[model samples]
Target: MSKKLTKNKKKYRDKISHNKKYSLEKAIEIIKKTNFVKFNASVDIAICLGIDPRLPDQMVRGSIKLPNGIGKNTIVLALVDQERELEAKESGADYVGLDYIEKIKSGWTDNIDVIVATPSVMNKLSILGKILGPKGLMPNPKMDTVSTDIKKSIEEFKYGKVFFKSDRYGIIHSSVGRISFSNQHLLENIKEFMRKIIQSKPSSSKGSYIKNVCLSSTMGSGSVSLDIKNFD
Candidate 1:
């Protein structure tokens, strides 16, 4: 059975054409205009890739520092030794030290957006993988969430560096900016994001790496597809 759309959602749906693909600029405009939610809605981009995620060789994933930061402030948790705690704190980590490991062990993982850990403390954190892994909070070397340079890692994350990975469906979804952002900022972010994804394309993947790109707001009734040619 189809679920009923709310009056507001219906109004939003009426504004969108399901079959048409829009330019990134036009799509951003539509997303901002149709965002009926009272609160500022995040503008998210979804890039559907032509890859078999099940085949690790074909996976595409990496991180990028957007030219225009996503509107949300990141709250960083640094899991480091005592000597590095001050470094982490000075670098903008909201929470620091190994105690949070115990806190995490006791189900105290709250108010933290990213977790950065030093090489020395990774062994201590290894036990909590079961708790943090599924949450995408577990510090990993590949994402730079685990590093010897605690300060740099913490600062990068606290500033704007965000990680992205392909889901089982081979689509990558990330927040480029908020509806309040100017069209230029959103456009640049989306382009840069696409460039970053393009850079991470696996050699094993063949033909038309990106299937389609779409943009949608937090409460938008439907996504506005984009002309993939623009990114190329």
Candidate 2:
């Protein structure tokens, strides 16, 4: 880190108390103030679930719509044939064509945020795995990113749809919205995500599904701990 960034981070670090876990509202307040960047930093949520991801039954992965959207008008890529290209575009998909595979092979994937692929086209994408897999942009049948309903999938992601998959450590992390959004919007997004997570709890799991929950911004070096207020 540069001396200036290091000096600035030191000043901001003192504002966030490592020992304290503020309630959701207060945590959001702190997260807003802690952002020192010139651009609007994305506000993100990270939840640690108590499910064994190793077990097929305990894996938690799904897509849900955010009430206020994920802060960005995500650019979506619909990998379909010539027939569905126009249909995909009409449904609000930014980039729609069967050329996605060729684009991937040529390293032309730059602005893509998510990809929706038809079931038939997915088999041809095996060669692009090494390029797309690590980026989490690969189409997956489980997440419904690979589907025959091209238009619906395009519209869903064009609006406010987000797909999340837990990491090896059972932590599901995603950006809820930007710092410019209202507290109500951010709070609603967080609550909606947690609600889905709870509803998706594995019946075979033995402990609390939501082991721990917190919210933090992309700017601050330290975590802005959140102690969410209990709800029924």
Best by TM-score: 1
What is the lDDT of every predicted structure here? 0.86, 0.82
How close to the true structure is residue 62 of candidate 1, measured as C-alpha lDDT? 68
Stretches off by above 4 angstroms in model 2 are 1-12, 228-232
lDDT digits (tens) for residues 86-169 of candidate 1: 888899889888888888999998888899888888889889999999998998887888898888887777768888999999
TM-score of each: 0.93, 0.86
Candidate 1 vs. true structure, TM-score: 0.93
Alpha-carbon RMSD to native, per candidate: 2.9, 2.6
User: What global local distance difference test value does model 1 have?
Assistant: 0.86
